[model samples]
Target: MAVGFAVLLTVGCGQGPQAQFSVRDTTEELLSPAQKAVKKALDDGFGTPHELVAWQRLPVNYGGVHGAVGEVLADGKGITAKWEGDAAGVTAGAPLLWISGARAAESTSVDSVGSFDAKTKTLTWSGAAEPAPAAGDKLVIGFGQTLKTGRMVYMKNCMHCHGVAGDGAGPTAKYLNPLPRDYRSGVFKFTSTLTPEKPTRDDLTRVVKYGIPGTYMPSFLWLGGKETESVVEYVRWLSMRGEFEKRLDDDLSGDFSQKAIEESAEKALAEFKAAKADEKPEKPRSAGDLKKEAVAKFTNETDGYEKTEFPGVIDDTANFLAQGWTHGEDPESLILPSVPRVPDDAASRERGRRMYLSDKGKCYTCHGIQGRGDGAATEDFWKKPGSDEVYERRGLHDAWGHPLMPRNLTLGQYRGGRRPLDVFRRIYAGIKGTPMPGFGRTALKDEEIWDVVNFVMSLQYQSAPAPAKPAEHVAESK
Candidate 1:
């Protein structure tokens, strides 16, 4: 059975905390005026955990009926409108969302819903708002309630660790060895999709239903199918929102960064000086005048981008997200094996072992030579991706910058699932957001990958101890 809303609301508090979604930590100083506007649009469209707007722009399945106001009642309490999609879901007690006109994007519960009049093809609802919806106003009834329901489930179950914004920095997050995922990055460590694509619904559903074996993420097998589906949609929605914010920042930063501003100001000053040098006036333009001119130019350029170009950028980003998400569900994005698994036998395991130790596999670089996860590379300094900056500590780190130790295969716990196909998929696509490179068609054949899978699967049963350290390393340690 699904957990009740009232019970979940106050799970960890004497008095339940008001439902609200936290914003990302990008400071305002870093954002230009245009970037801030994009952020505001996101906030309005997505709304709080309680007051969700099924931002028609996103690909999320908000699962509710929609329509537009046909006529406002004379008494200012209700409206008649033509309904579309899932008309049955628009029953009494379902919330009505006003998406246009004066009360745009606001939602209120319905006191009652009048029966559909087939002749007029319209229905009536009362108790929506003090000021009723205006004619031709777009509205949704029973819409995005799934999001609200999913938010309740997430708050009760996942928020303590994942946080309100899915930043993975919830109150208990710091203490966990492997921190909970930050969905804002729109990256998942394990997925069936190709390395470049996002996880499909089935992939996420599997994780939620059957939690990672070695990690603190526990299974929620008891949650019914509908509950699971709603939560998955919610998670996907959160990921999309996060990805959208990041894209906006990346696009705006090139022009709006403090360094960019300074450069623009300096360039303006240089041009002014150059032009004034030609003028040869008795007294050249004063330093104050030059500074003012530079400031004015900088302001004008920024204002221009904000007013003219930023909206298009925002729209393009949304369209990109929608297309990408929609494409993720396509079968082409999934990784399917060309051949069946090589028979799990002594020869196959040995062949797999060879691949593990070979430079081609390079598995030993991180997962120790004997599958113990104590590889020498963990002690070496590594540079962060996309930057020359070196990490302060020596160890492997995931995309999130959290220190990560490669799997100790001997432990027999596979976070991505232990099935042979699961292991094969891991090798084919590589683990997303990790150093685990996929040994797909380019690196290894389908049969060869299967052999490696067999070898990995056999590690748990081996009773042999890990090989001893080398003599030089032992002496250095001493």
Candidate 2:
């Protein structure tokens, strides 16, 4: 299979050695430009074993280019690009391609005015993870399909923060708490603590598969392995290319002194990586080490920055992170926003009470009927690595970097904060990368969200105790 694609359709049938043989001008043989491309591919060794993958569509008609050597001819005629030699399979149902045709009668051409890449390959449309389920036979896998998948993944996952080029400077980066990882820096925060070098592909896979624990990184495991693997591979490619761009930028920057710039590119680049190596990897230290270091590192002289950055580590600031390379089995010991219980709000509490019980809100499902976080969804259930003992935990965290318990509405401490506006925002934005989905995206309206917000705020209501039950009274009388 020809591995590359081109924007031009100048494949000259008349110019090459395998020039068009006398194509039987069958009366019923009117083929679209795309069909012609396929026919050309098929007629010229582009069929089966090497399936057809159209990069884009061709014009529906190209009858005017009779004088032009490579121009697709006639209505229903298409252009074909012959590979240099025998090639492997063309990805199935190739990406949506563009086709243009010349109007012979008018003696002119119209440009491609629209485009849309196929969302998913035909072949993998069935499923991923366990097995490839049945799909349309027309589906396929290969270069075109991979390219489209990569673009879709980028738009869906990386664009808002990673930027179109995989750099950290996305549109939303400025408003973020911790800035997005600058892929161009070549400094990844998480690699295997076991390995010193840059993270391997599996490392990236693990991140994509499980997602980063305490960040905006959302777990796309629902997208499944095939897409995940493709994404990982594409990310690696993007990272490598980004590193190349960094080099280009560095050279262009005035940072390099005349003497240093004169030195070979190899030496300068090597020195940069060597100087950066130690800073990039932070092996997980024991609890004792972290406690000791926390003490020493917290000293004003250390600027509280001696170990590592975690939320709330910086004194007298709204922002913080823990200090040093702390690692542990305790789920609570992570970067999160600390949130306290909601204070009393009688009126809103009543509304929240009803909403908690209602099937539509179903807040009780995982959060518990009491809003205690120990709902039936949690209790004893577990997701683990092929074992019986349930970890019985989901890796969610809060602003104070503690294990996020669902807001015990009774307690009133909402993790997003207890303010009505804060509560409304949570109901609206729905914590970007978590199981708590935003109802606003569906049928729920802003006012309804406000109602829920009002109810959540009111959970602090306290009423007088009820009278004793009759059974209890009889026992007392006896």
Candidate 3:
């Protein structure tokens, strides 16, 4: 047995991570004590696509809103917070919905000391403790030469729900069933695999690329190619400031400074008269300082290695298919009428077809009269009674002013994932934004979902993997 100390300097660790324990993979036998500790952590949650986290642990800091209180579970599964302390007022200003980011996104709440607004969206902010001057507070609004393209992307598509200032508090917030992300508090929910905190850049990029399904969020992949990357950049910048401001606020107010200052003030009439003129004056933001900070952020991020070329369609499909193995939704050993095995003969396929068309399952309504998404109800689709109309609330427009339609699943682009289990999860969980309901206990049995699952999988929903050329023929042909 061979073992050596594994040392790793992590972002959270004071020094570079140095695993004191040794590890023992098939290649490694005896390990130093140091490697053992590192191995233990990995044994906890390490192997997933979420690289930074190996185990579930409580967050050191979780509040996203300045002075907002939050709690994390010991199990490391969830965290919740109250936007406002006033219970009754919370109801009055109830946000439609809240996008849950991970611990990293929450960190954004700490740094935001200022805000920016465009048109009707008025983003506001509370500066971080020991904060520096901010550009959004001065130059863009006052100097008035900020790029319309960069600002417009965010203001038009994101600001209404995320809050103009990125503090997660826009006026339309109440109307949204799920309040938009207060990127200021950098927490994010969707991640590729098991990650510890706010998703890494790729995680965020993917989310923006593939919006949450069955929810108010729709796929923005088309809008996310290179030209739209600027929008993502703006969002990332907003989230950074929000998290920083939030963290600073918590640190400063941790000692009861707000209360102490209020109690220490003199209330005497004569004193008040004398102090009126001496009241603290408003501190104006300095343009030079903010410009320097923004420049610094841009430079550092740009310094990283750049990806050279587009992998094209075949590579893209392969990458996702490989990822699908682990990312597919949880599967169960379901027992129902749905076919589970790959049919070997026409007889089995016939039975499967019968099950799909059978009155017991009648899976053809919304799916379409003939498996196409263009069912008779397509033109007549209406928002269910209890559901809110997300598109209506947006009330914004693109350069051309046409409305977007809901996804026609029969199209086969399956953004959630193309894996069998992923499709199964969709079949069982239903979608969010529409009238789809979970089949877990309702109409379909596990076996029946499998039956439809097989039927759906049989549909020509995805393109075939590109073929590889034969090595022997390639040289001769050339």
Q: Which model scores highest in TM-score?
A: 1
lDDT of 3 by residue, 389-409 (tens): 433422221111222233354
Q: Which of candidates 2 and 3 is the stronger one according to lDDT?
A: 2
lDDT of 2 by residue, 3-81 (tens): 1222222332332122122222220132122124223432322111122222222111111111111322233222222
Predicted structure 1, TM vs. truth: 0.76
For residues 1-478, write the lDDT of model 1, one tens digit per residue.
Answer: 1111010011223323445666555524333454456567566656655455566777787766788877877776566777776466776655555666666523333334544554555566665455556788877766665676677678778888888878888889999979999999899988988878888999999999999988888899999887898899989988988888878777766555544555566766676667755665343444445445434433465565665676788788888888888888889999888988889999998788777777667787788888989888888899999999999989888999988888898988989887888899999999988888888978889999999999988989989944633442335435
Which of the two, 1 or 2, has more TM-score? Answer: 1
Q: For each candidate, C-alpha RMSD in Å?
A: 8.8, 24.6, 27.9
Against the hidden reference, what TM-scores do the models get?
0.76, 0.28, 0.30
Q: How many residue pairs clash in each candidate?
A: 0, 44, 70
